[model samples]
Target: MEEVKFGQDINKQKHKKMNQTVLITGASTGIGLEMAKQLAAKKFNLILVARSAEKLQEIQKHLQDQEGVTVKIFAKDLSNSANAISLYNDVKRENSKVDMLINNAGVGLYGNFTETSLDAELDMIELNISSLVALTKLFAQDMLILKSGKIMNVASLLAFLPFPYYSVYSATKAFVLAFSETLAAELEGTGVTVTTLCPGPIDTPFNTDSMLTTNAYKANKPMPASVVAESGVDLLLDGKGKKLVGFNNWFISNLPRFTPDFIMMKIKKNLASQRK
Candidate 1:
C-alpha cells in the first residue's frame, strides 16, 4: 500500500511539471509582460501573444536567457474579431497544451464617448469585451475537455463605478467582473477555475498609454505592476473567485455594491473635485 501511494505521488508531481504551460495575450508590454515574467520564473512554459513581433521577440529573448523557460511568441492583433479563435487554432497547430489562459489584451479610450472617435471606441470594444469573451470561451472549452485549467481576466477598479471620462472602459470591466463571476459558478463542478482580478491603478505602460496616469487622482494612487501581477496570479491559483488587488481596493470595490447610489455619486463628486 505504501509503495502504491508513493507511485501516485510521483505521478502527480511529474504531471504537474509537464503541464505548466500558460498562454498570455498582449504580452508585449504592461501587466501582460509582467505576468509572463512571473510565470516564467516559476518554470512554466510560456506562449506570449501580442501585436508586435519585434517586442515579442525581445521578451522571448529575455525569458530564454534569464529563466531558461520555453517561450513561444504569437504576434497577432487581437482587436480583430476573428483573431481570438484564430489564436486558439494556431496554438493547437503547435501541438502545445494550454494549461492556463490570461485574457489581458484590452485597450482604453480616455475621453468622452462623443469626443472619442467611433472607430477607436469600436476597436476598444472589440479588444476589451469581445475578444476576451471569445478567448475565454474557446480556451475554456479545451480546459473543460481536459478536466482542468485556470483563467484570469484583468478587470479594473473602474468596474465598481460608472465613471464619466472612462465610461466605456468602466462598462467593459463591469462586464468582465459579472461574466467571470457567473462563469466561475457554472464551472465549479468541472475542474476549471476562473478569477477576475480587479486591480486599482497599476503603474505600467497601461497607465501612460491608456491616459490613465494623466488623471491626477489615478496618477497619485499608483500601485506597482509586479504587485498587482503577483497578487492577481496568486489569487487565481488559489481558486479565489474575485479579488481586488489592494486592501483598500477590495473595500472600495465592494463599497459600491452596498453603498447607496446617491451617496456614491456625492463621494465621487467630492473626489473628482480634489483631483482638479
Candidate 2:
C-alpha cells in the first residue's frame, strides 16, 4: 500500500511537470488575476505581466504557495510599443514555451472625445490596440512553430455599439473582436486557436475609478471578475471563437445590430450621460 501511494505521488508530479505555461497581461488584478488563479489551480505554470511589480510579486508568491505551480512575474508598461516588444523578447530569452497568451492589458477613458485628454486617449490606443497586435504577432509566430497554442483577447460588449463617451475604448475593443475572429479563421487547422472574450462591466480595479459611479454601471450589477475569468478560460481552452459573458450583455451586444442606427445612438447617448 505504501509503495502504491508513492507511485501515485510520482505520477502527480509527472502530470504537474507536463502542464502547459500560460502568460497573462494585466495579471496583477481583476480578470487577469482571477484567470491566473484558476489556471494555477489546474497546475498550469504562469507568467504574469503587469505594470505593478509589487502586486505581481504578491500574487506570484501566494499562487505558488497555494497551488504549487511555477509563477513568473514581469512588470512592463505595455502602452509603449517598445515595451510590448521587449516583453515578448524577454519571454523568448527565458526559453519558456508560452502555451497560452492572454491579451488583457487595456485602459478606458470616460468623457466626450474632444474633452478627454488627447495623451490619455493615445496611450489607451497604444495599450489596447497596438500592444495587443504586437504581442499577438510575436507570440503567434512561436505558437505556429509549436503548432499548439491558445489565445484569449479580452474585448468588451461595447465593441458591438457606438459608445459616445467611450469612443476610443469602444473602437479599440471593436478592433480586438474583429481581429481575433479573423485570426481564428486564418489559423484554422494550424493547431492554434484564438478566442475573444466580450464581457460586460466587470467589478475590477479597472472599473473602480471610472465606470463604477455611473448609473448604467449601477443599473447592471458588474459581473464578478472571477466569474468572467473562469468563463473566458473555459472558452479559450475549448477553442471557442467568440464569447460574450452574461445574458444581458450578450443581448445588448446583439441588439445593436438589429436596432435602428438613430435609436441605438440615442440609447448610447443616454447611457453615457449617466457617468458623473
Candidate 3:
C-alpha cells in the first residue's frame, strides 16, 4: 500500500450510499453508545453491535426516531473470535456498506495477575486483542476495495504503562495500541484510516462492574463517556492516527518516557493497591 498523507478530506470521499454507515461494537452503552448518538446527529447511518439485543433495539429505535437515520442492530458476544467473524459476514450479507468501523467492545479484569481467573484473562485477550484484529481485518479489506473508510479502535490510558492490579487488562490494551498503530501505517495510502482512542477512566457501567467498585476506584473521578466519545469521533474524522482523550491522560501517557522505570512502577503499584 502506498503511504497517503494524513488529513485527506473524508467528507469528499464518495460512498455507495448518500449517507455513510458507521459500525460500532459495544454500542449498547458508554462511549460506544455516545458515539452512536453523536454520529446519528451528523446523519450517518449506524450498525450497533453488542451482547444485549434488547438494549440495542432500544437504542436502534431511539436513533431512528430522533435523528431520522437508519440503525441496524447485531447482538453477539464478540469475545469469541468466531462470533467476530460472523458479525462481518452478517453485515456483508445485509449489504450494509460500512464507511467506518469502531472496535469498542472490551472488558477488563482488575486484580493481582496471580489471583485473577486465568480463564477470564484469556477471554479478555480474545475480546480486547484477537477479536479486534479479526474485525479490523475483515472490514479493512472491504474498505480497501472501496478505496475509502475509517476505523477507530478504543484503547485505554493504561496502555501506556503497566498497572499492577490491571496487569492483564493493561497488557491487552497495550496490544491494541501497538496493533492499531502498525495497522494504520500498513494501510497508509489505501484510502482507509485507522485511529486509536486511548481514553482514561470513564464514568460508565463498565467501571461499575464488581472488580472496579473498590473504594480506591471510587476515589478517582472519571471523565464522562460522552466527552471521550466526542473527542474520539472528532479525531477519527480528522484522520488522526491516535488520540488520548483528556489533557491529564495525555500528560500521563507521555510522562512514562521521562520518569524512571522504577519510579513509574512504584507509582503504578501504589495506585493499584487502592482497588482493594
Candidate 4:
C-alpha cells in the first residue's frame, strides 16, 4: 500500500454531516481521549465509552463546552465479554447513528505466561480481541447499512513482530492489524473505510506502566498520544488503510524483516532489561 501523508488540508477537505455520531471506546484517557478532542474540534457528535463514568462525564463537559460538539458518555467495562454487544445495543436504544467507529479500548500484559495470571490474560483477550471484534461486527453492519462510515482500530508496532515478553499483547495487536487490512479490502467501494493505527511506543499512561517499554529498551522516538491520535484520525479520514506513527518507529518496525533473527533478539533482550 502507498504511504499516506498527514496534514491539515486532508482534514478540512472532508465535510462533516450535521450531528453525525462517532463512537470511541476507551475514550476516558490517553490516545482515545485525544481522538475524541480532535473529532469534537471538527464538530462530530461523540459517544465516549470507558469504565470510568466520572472521567467520561468530565471529558464530555470539556469537549462540549470548548468544541461545541454533542457528546455522550457510556461508563462500561469493555473487558467484560457481554459488554461489547450491550454497548452497541445501548447506542441503538439512544437512537444515535454511528458515523465513525474507533475501536481503541484495549489492555496489555507483560511477563512470561507463568508470571501472568490466567484471569489477566483472559481479560486481555476478551477486551483486546473479543470485545474489539464484537464491536466491529456490530458497528460495521451499521456502517454497511448507512453505506458510509469509517472504523479505526488502534493496533501497535508489536503487530509486526513476536516480542519476547509481551507475547499476548503482540498477538492481540497482530489480530487487529491483519483484521483491519482484510476488512478494508472487503469493504471497498462501499463508501466505508477501515484503518489500523499501528503506533510504536506512544507516550501514554498505558506505556508508562508497561515493562515492554521500560525494560526492553528506549524508543527511537516516542510520540505524544495526542499526535498519534490526531495523525491516525487524519489517515483514516483520508481513506488510508495502515499508518506507522513516528518516522523512527516506521523504520525500526520494518527493519526486523531484513535483519537477522539473532540481531533482533539481542535488541529485544536489551530493551527488556530496561524494565527493571
| lDDT tens readout by residue for model 1, 1-276 | 999999999989866854589899989877789888988887788999999999999999999899888999999898886988898899999898999989988887666578888887788888898999999998999999999999999888888765666778889889998999999999998999999888877676665444543443563487888888888668766757777778877776676778898998776544433333
Candidate 4: tens digits of C-alpha lDDT, residues 1-276: 233444444544444443588899999888999998888887788999999999998999999899888898899898886999899999999888898899999988777777878898889989998999999988899889889998999898889865777888889999999999999999999988999998887666786445644644454546788989988779766748788887877787887889999999888766755544
**Cα lDDT for residue 274, model 3?**
48
- What TM-score would each prediction reach against the true structure? 0.89, 0.92, 0.90, 0.90
Better of 2 and 4 by TM-score: 2
Order of quality (TM-score): 2, 3, 4, 1
- Model 4 backbone overlap count: 9
Each model's Cα RMSD: 2.7, 3.3, 5.5, 5.6
Candidate rank order under lDDT: 2, 3, 4, 1
Segments in model 3 whose C-alpha atoms lie over 4 Å from true places: 1-18, 209-220
For the record, the alpha-carbon RMSD of candidate 3 to the native fold, in angstroms, is 5.5
- Write one digit per residue (lDDT tens) for candidate 2, span 47-153: 99999999998999999999998899999998887899999889889898898999999988888788889999889999999999999999998999989899999
User: What lDDT would candidate 3 get against the real structure?
Assistant: 0.87
Question: Which candidate would rank higher by lDDT, 2 or 3?
Answer: 2
- Candidate 4 segments whose C-alpha is farther than 4 A from its true place: 1-15, 208-217
For 9-61, candidate 3 gives per-residue lDDT tens digits of 34344333338899999999899999999988888899999999999999999
| Total backbone clashes of candidate 2, pairs 3 or more residues apart or in separate chains | 0
